[model samples]
Target: MRRAMTDQLSGRLVEGGHRLDVRVYFEDTDFSGVVYHARYLHFLERGRTDFLRLHGIGHRALMDGAFGEPMAFAVRRMEIEFLRPARIDDVLQVETRTALLGGARVVLDQRILRDGEVLVEAAVKVAVISPDGRPRRMPPAVAERLGAPAS
Candidate 1:
């Protein structure tokens, strides 16, 4: 069912990425009702998380060492741009795609859009780490799965 079940709650894996629809609630906005800039990070994070989940590389399994050694993913860097503001009640789509994959990190490009108009864009770098927070090489199976197509 590749890219065919966007109506699912967790969103769906698209042809080249993942798509999630998020509602702009009052709590996601500020005093003026515009979405808070920081909140966009959460939306983007969820997109990435779900993307990995759909790719069969869930964080819970990785942290539980289902890949053979316990590890976690952490944001190493993020470059974001706010193109426009979203107000309450708006339904925004967050799109996420893998831009790069390395031995110990993955770079993702994300965007938030309303009615097909891009409102925000971001480039995020995520690193694999051990339970002690030390940097570590991404497990081979994990990297392979990330580079491979979704089932």
Candidate 2:
């Protein structure tokens, strides 16, 4: 309870159905002076990772399992829109929403914002897989915690 309250106040952790903010760095930009298109993908990935972390899902644990098999998630598809441009040192925020949760897939809606302006938007699809790269069902406990599958 106390930890929850603190995280809420500090903005390091978010509540259920929440948004997390992240800043953009020079390394995220390209020689063209604007954020590279691929950089947006990185931002979205971080947003999803943070969302899961805040919800107590340790990605490392999933990857480095006790059975010596590295569980992983792979991006299967993405639809992105570049609404605006972002530059070096821009303090951008990646807003993430859990759009869908499935037995073997997760979909995320993410937006990169700068001072209330949308720079980019994306819908990303990810599939969970075993070390051998075979699709796997998401753990029941994790699924229950993330709420029902998107219908």
Candidate 3:
């Protein structure tokens, strides 16, 4: 039997956090054969997205007016620390956990690891916004599903 699309793309929730596995391809590497700094951001983003999906929240639905208006998440700020370098053909795991959730903002702590060794760490703050870009609070049902307090 074919697996569901979400099953194939979503990560598992572990210990109140999410874990997504990512493989580094040639294109994700720089001239020195190490993962490009910016590519780590892509991996981290995927982990966060999948984390939300696993909780029954999807970006498409948000943008499709699921909550009275088309909405999206915008990264308000991010602090990243590059600890070790990842090489081509390496499989990395991205771990993400919600650190804080507010009416219109969510903060997440993310880490990239290879074989249990930390490679990168990041703290991300994202704001929920309407399509027009104004800040908006997340729906109560959505927040509750995500284990966050609804404002």
Tens digits of lDDT, candidate 1, 104-139: 888888999999999999999999999999999988
Q: Rate the local accuracy (lDDT) of all candidates.
A: 0.89, 0.75, 0.89
Candidate 2, residue 60: lDDT: 85
RMSD of each: 4.0, 4.0, 2.1
* Candidate 3 worst ten-residue window by lDDT: 142-151
By TM-score, the better pick of 2 and 3 is 3
Indicate whether candidate 2 or candidate 3 has the larger lDDT: 3
lDDT tens digits, residue span 1-151, model 2: 9977745633354444446566667788788778888988887777777777676665887787732346777889999999999988787777776778998888877788899999898988989899788998877766765563348
Q: Which candidate comes out best when scored by lDDT?
A: 1
Which residue pairs in candidate 3 have backbone atoms (N, alpha carbon, C) closer than 3 angstroms, thus clashing?
none
Judged by whole-model lDDT over C-alpha atoms, candidate 3 comes out at 0.89
Most TM-score-accurate candidate: 3
Clashing pairs in 2: none
lDDT for each residue of candidate 3 in 67-149, tens digit (9 for 90 to 100): 66788989999999999999999999999988888888888899999999999999999999999999999887766766743
- In angstroms, what RMSD does candidate 3 have relative to the true structure? 2.1
- Angstrom error at residue 145, model 3: 2.0
Model 2 per-residue lDDT at 132: 86
